[model samples]
Target: MPRRHRLTPEKHLKHAPWRFTATDKAVLTRLAQYRYLKSLTLQKLTGRPIATVNYSLRKLFDRRLIDKPHRQVEGFNHLNAPDIYEINARGRRWLTEEVPEVTTLSRTHTEGPPKHFAHSVAICDALAEIELEVATAGNAFIPAATILAKATVPNPLKMPCTIEHTFPNGKHERLETFIIPDGVYGVRYPDGRSELVFLEVERCNPRNPQTLFRASLLRKTLSYRALREAETARCLGKKSFGVRFIGLSDR
Candidate 1:
């Protein structure tokens, strides 16, 4: 049986940059389907090497589009069990909002001598909503109007609702506060698939230290989560998934 997702509108993860790339879109699409993955899976899926996949994974984490879920079987060689990977809310949004809409020659057309950079606000807004959808995973149903309503409001910080968790045996080992709003959405990637992606938008500084630091933290957290979730599901014989991050820069 296929997996089902649950999304909410509350603010769980950070935002994706304005300028996401084509490769980035492909990666995100992969995650939207699987939810989690391993580096070897990605290499096989995308026909890339482990080094390239690792590098892209780092970049995606920095942009905050993906997160880790838990670990799973690692190597096919029987060397030992390796870690599993999962996708987060951000990656889902990119897949639905950005990737499928892309035409094969659109990139070349845009960069051709004619020079057509038709970046539309509607498109951006759509992407944002898609991102928001991924952030919520498949838990809830969120409408674009609701997001616009919140975005229009002046920093109210009021999501439709919120949820608090007490997972003593979980990794956080404490009461966790997860903002659960009505319009949240999130995406997951296939385990060890190359479709996982990273997107980054550079509107200001090409190298923002602060953003980078937060992104790193988010990635680590996401990776750990994917691994844990996978193990739990495997042990319990339940459907498992993972999360991957993508970064986008508009600059």
Candidate 2:
């Protein structure tokens, strides 16, 4: 078998003022997925040390490729939380020019409280894990498009609502719609069978059986059921996709 051609900065890009390394290319490729990532997340995704990741990230930050959310202040009560980093316009352009493996470039920025910050980090972490796992096994892996409510693509998912009717047959009709998950992607196995997956990252700790039945988890399950039972999407030629929600929970 021929050797796999791993992407290298020198091979694809011109190294002038500052040199880009394998780790740098890896960072850019992963950021191609729409999400904000911190140094710890990058360390985990790239298998590099915290210092090394920080060094590379700082360089990228200096070059105007990445920036922390303007609102996040690294101070007391928020320990071990890496600075949230998102690719900027320059970063997007550089990735598009330097990396052929990166087909698209999208910007993801974060600006909010720390808990909310943690939630998004958890989401990126989950996606990064899947990307690594599938690629390691040589299976075909497609990263999901980032779900942004404000983005251009129209989202079909809607919040649960009640509709009133004037007729005596019924007082009202409960309108239900599926929830757009944190991420969505497809995976094709070697046997030609494939699966579309929906990922939900719950940063909160696991709840008890009783408590779990009413909150976000319950709503998510109902939405998944609605989508699957109703043929929300079709795959291949005849088979419709049944989304399986992979929940990533962290303390």
lDDT digits (tens) for residues 1-251 of candidate 2? 65522111223233337987877777776666645676677787778888888778767766667666654452312334566677766777788778865532122343323456556655766666776687788887754432232234344333232222232443333344445566665677899977766667664534322332244555566556665555554322223554444554333
Which 10-residue window of candidate 1 scores lowest in summed lDDT? 103-112
lDDT of 1 by residue, 15-105 (tens): 5444555545555654444334445555555556677666666556555566533212121332353233444555555565665542110
User: What do the candidate models score in CA lDDT, each in turn?
Assistant: 0.37, 0.56
Q: What's the CA error at residue 36 for candidate 2, in Å? A: 1.8
The Cα RMSD of model 1 versus the native structure comes to 20.7
Cα error, candidate 2, residue 156 (Å): 6.3
Residue 132's lDDT within candidate 2 is 69
Instruction: Please estimate how well model 1 matches the true structure, expressed as its whole-model Cα lDDT.
Output: 0.37
* TM-score (all chains, Cα) for each model: 0.30, 0.63
Candidate 2 error regions (>4 Å): 1-16, 44-52, 70-83, 100-116, 145-173, 203-215, 235-251
lDDT for 130 (candidate 2): 74
